[model samples]
Target: MYQLAPNIELLFTEAGPDAADRVRAAAAAGFDAVEMWGTSDKDVASLAGALQETGVSLTSLLAEPRTNFTLPGTDLGPFFTGLDRAVENAGLLGCPRVVLGSGIGFPGAKRPQNLARLVEVFTEAVERTRGSGVRLVLEPVNTRVDHPGALLDRTADAVLVAREVGSDSFGLLYDLYHSITEGEDPAAELANAAGLVDYVQIADAPGRGEPGSGAIDWAERLSVLRASGYDGPIGLEYFPTTPSVESLAHIKAVARDA
Candidate 1:
């Protein structure tokens, strides 16, 4: 079975105030792994200690400062600074992946032009993290619901950039919620994204909540991802209508079956 990693940032709030406490909460919820947004501002030492105490592996985190990737002549200094911190902190937590977003679309810029810049940025990032064992993943967020004007909302665009960048340390994150929210069928999209995805994130559509609360057939989704031969940890990055534990009841079984 593919390993499950709970997003402690959005899920597992029952664990309480401190992020380390949330790590413990995820462990208690029966997940052997946990993920977060960025570890830069958090207590990495304490979080590391909790992971050691609970034996939960840190799977992934966001590329800090949420660097945007759409403009041609935009300054990348701030983004790389944040990336450096993200790498150091992720190494401390023993995480191997960091998520990046394709900021907003550039005004008066062609898609190809922006994508070229995106590839260049990720290429440099890939070089920076080379030998550190950390992989950079570009994620596509939905525009209609959560993120309007988001440059790379389609999974295919992420696939394009990842392919153009062409590095083992860089790939796309196939987010099921965003795909469904965009009205694209996962079964069809997964076929094209089969080899390009470095990680998987899922929340149901409509409310971005638990699997059973929305319209996605997770069993079919997971089965399709499996057929794509993706065996990485699937991040359950969702909001729960009830307690986090209660939310997992439906998808946990689906994951087990997957």
Candidate 2:
């Protein structure tokens, strides 16, 4: 069975706003792992304490104040600074990965040129976070629905960037929801991106809701994922149509069979 990490930002909000309490709620729900977006707004001390007390692992968190490498003359100092802070917080929370994004590309630049620039920026980002015991995973968000105009939308493109970056510390975050929303075939994409995906997240397509609430065949998809050789924790990053626990029933059962 694949270990599932529910995203606290979207799941378990029934526990209230304090992320620390959410950690507790996720634990009570029998989750041993959780993920979140940014840490800046959270009570780090309490969150860390909750994780320690509950023995729940933080799978990953976002690299904040995302830098748009495609934007000409964009200052990268803040991005690196934010990365450093993120690494520090990850250390505190025992998080293993930091998710990075290629913000909207420069309007006037060619796609190849923008992607090349990403290679340079992420190369340095890997170096900057070296020895932190934190792996960097670049995510390709869908532009069509959730993230309009996002520079990196295709899983193939993200795999290319991760390949170009050429660091063991850097890899790809294959979000099944985004890939499906962007109209790519999961089996084909996962096949091409095999061995490079360090993390995976999921939500049902057509509405980005919990698994059974949408059209995806979880058993088939999970089988394809396993076939791709990614035996890692899958982050449950979907919005629930019902209570969080109730929303998980389908995927949890499907995953167990998968």
Candidate 3:
């Protein structure tokens, strides 16, 4: 089974949901690794201290503050600034990967043109993070479900963007729930993703709930992951149906079944 990195940003809200509190809560919930989003806007000292105290490893975080990646007109200055800050924080947290949300599609532009702009910006982003020990993965969300009009919703598109970037520093975030929501076959997609995936995240489709709460076959999903030899952390980025500890029953079930 893949090591699970609980997304503290989406889980562990019972303990005040403060960044450090989430880290401590994830550890208390028996998770050894955790991922976060928007950690740059949080108290890094406290978060870093909590990780140190709990001995929890940081898995991944967002590359920049959430913004539209598909737009050619939007100024990338703030995005790049946020990326630099995130890289620095990743260094402090010992996080190896960061995720990028390929935002909603651009209005009044062809898809190729939008992708072209995205490639250009990410090219610069990859260069900017050179030697930072931090790598990037473009995260593809499902447009038909949770994210309408989201660009880069397909795993293939993210892989294509990473290929165009042509840098080892860039890769794809294969989120299973999103792919399933988008009506993708997870196993075939993972097989297609083969070499370009840097990270993985999971949630159940239809409601974005815990693994077993929806129609997703996590057993099959994990099987494909194992077959693909994906060594990266699999983030538990889902909404719990109950208390945080109670939410982990699925993880236990997965381990036992595996």
Candidate 4:
């Protein structure tokens, strides 16, 4: 069996149910850790209580209230406020990671300017929680299907950004499905970015379901991750074409047998 953490985002039928119940259900189903989206579906305190009761750790959560991909140089007062609130909530839940996605890219804005803005925003975020022990993870989403306009689409680009910031508190989330769908060789890309990668999430391409549900060789890819020295928990941020429980079973099987 995989001796790592997993998020509960894949288990939800919708974002409509109680967050605590979702965490409890994931724990009951045998996940060591569970990550949640923003505080939209439910309150953070209730989710924290459920985690405490089940003894499951809140692995990660999203920084919310950011409507657009406002870079650092622009007006980011609102974005920083949301990030601070998210950091505080993450600290409360005892979660060590916070997945931070840059806002959508604006074609009108200059590339250099946007990159500079991102560095500023991330640097500020790192500075806010100097001793909190929470990592602000930047996720590069695939612009093909789900998120078509995300700022950081390439893993290499994420690594560059992380290197520019040069802080342990800031790192990359490295979603495999997005990287694969965007035509990146996960192994080579990850190898090139081994230093900046802090967390890794996985799902098959095309369908965004569990491993082995699509054409991707999940076992080979996972073995590559293991060989590459990434022992972090793989986040299951996928969409279930079928029911979630069935998909979860498939994911567990893949992890156990791979």
Candidate 5:
């Protein structure tokens, strides 16, 4: 069975008494590893302390100032600087994965030229972090519901970019919610991009909440993942309609039964 890590971004809405307290809460709730979103407001020292206190592992974090720097016209220099900081922080926090987002689509830019820019940028970023031991996860946000105008909305397209970039340190962050919202069949599409998918995250299709809270069958989906040989942690990335602890309790139970 693939291990699952709780995404602390949803569970702990506040920074609480201190960052270490957050790690305690995660452990109390039965999670061994914790993940975070944008680290803009976080104090690195406190988070580092928390990990030490609770023995909770820091799984992954999204690169800071989460913006679409991948758009054709946006300057990539600043984005690269932020990414470098994220890499440095990952080393301190013991996180193995960093989520990378591509900005929006350029209305007038030629599609192929824009794609080439993405390839070049990702290749350079990988080179800079070659010795850090942190892998970059490129995610395709769904343009249909949440982010409209995102350039890398298709999993297959992102896989193509990964191949073009030719970096073993970079790979796709296959998110099931966005793929379903955009009308892509997860099993079939994942099959096509089989070897290229490095990490997989999931949420129910319509609500972007916990699986089994909506129409998607967590059991069947997980079966597909296991059959396909993806033994990575199943990331719980979603917004909670109620308090995160309660919502996640349901998710844990469902995942257990599945």
Candidate 6:
């Protein structure tokens, strides 16, 4: 069975704004792991305490300020500063990974040029974060539905950038929801991405809701993921149309046997 880390930002809001309480709630609900977007606004002390008390692992968190390398003349100082902060917080939370994004591309810049810029920026990022014990995973978000005009929308492109960065510390976050929403086949993309994927996340397509709320074949997709050789925890990064626990029933059942 695969371990599932629910995204607390979207999963346990019923526990209210303090993510520390959400960590406790998730632990009570039998989740041993959770993920979130950013830590800038959170009480790190409280969060760390809760995780320690509950023994729940923080699987991943976002790299803040999501630097847009495609934008010309963009100041990178703040981006690097934010990354340092992210690494610090990850250390406090015992998180293993930090998710990075391409941000929206600079208007009228060629896609290749944008991707090349991403390579340059991420190469430096990987080098900077080396030996921190926190792996950096670059995510390719869907531009069509949720993130319009996002620079890295294709899984192949993300894999290429990860390849160019050429470090085990730097790898890809192959989000299945975003991939399907972008009209890519799961089997094919997972095959192409292969061993480079260090993280994975999921939501059903069309509505971005919990699995079974949309058209994806969970068993088939999970099988494809297994075949692709990624044994890491999968982040449940979907919105719920029902109560969070109820929303998980479908994927939980499917994943248990997958």
Q: TM-score for each prediction?
A: 0.95, 0.97, 0.94, 0.91, 0.92, 0.97
lDDT of each: 0.85, 0.91, 0.82, 0.76, 0.79, 0.90
Better of 5 and 6 by lDDT: 6
Q: What TM-score does prediction 5 earn? A: 0.92
In order, what is each prediction's RMSD in angstroms?
1.6, 1.2, 1.7, 2.4, 2.0, 1.2
> 1-258 in candidate 2: lDDT tens per residue?
999999999999999999999999999999999999998899999999999999999999998886534456677876887788899999999999999989987567788987888899999999888899999999999999988888999999998988999999999999999999999998899888877899999999889999999989999999999888988999999989999999999989998877
How many steric clashes does model 4 contain?
Answer: 2
User: Where does candidate 4 have its weakest 10-residue lDDT segment?
Assistant: 65-74
Q: Over the full model, what C-alpha lDDT does candidate 4 score relative to the true structure?
A: 0.76
Q: Candidate 6: lDDT over CA atoms? A: 0.90
lDDT of 1 by residue, 65-97 (tens): 774544455767778888888888888988888
Superposition error at 167 for model 1 (Å): 0.8
In model 4, which runs have C-alpha deviations exceeding 4 angstroms? 1-6, 12-16, 66-73
In model 1, how large is the Cα lDDT of residue 180?
87
Worst 10 residues of 1 by lDDT: 64-73
What's the C-alpha lDDT at position 93 in model 5?
88
lDDT of 4 by residue, 1-258 (tens): 454455565665444477788777777677778777776556878888988999988777888764434654446777777787788888889988888887775446776666766787789889987888889898888888878767777888778788889997888888889999999988898888887777888788778876668988777887887777787777787766766666777667767854
What is candidate 3's lDDT per residue for 212-245, written digit by digit as tens?
8887777777877777878667888898888877
Instruction: Output the lDDT of residue 210, model 4.
Output: 68
The better-scoring model by lDDT among 4 and 5 is: 5
Q: How close is candidate 6 to the true structure, as a TM-score?
A: 0.97
List the candidate 6 regions with Cα displacement exceeding 4 Å: 67-72, 106-108
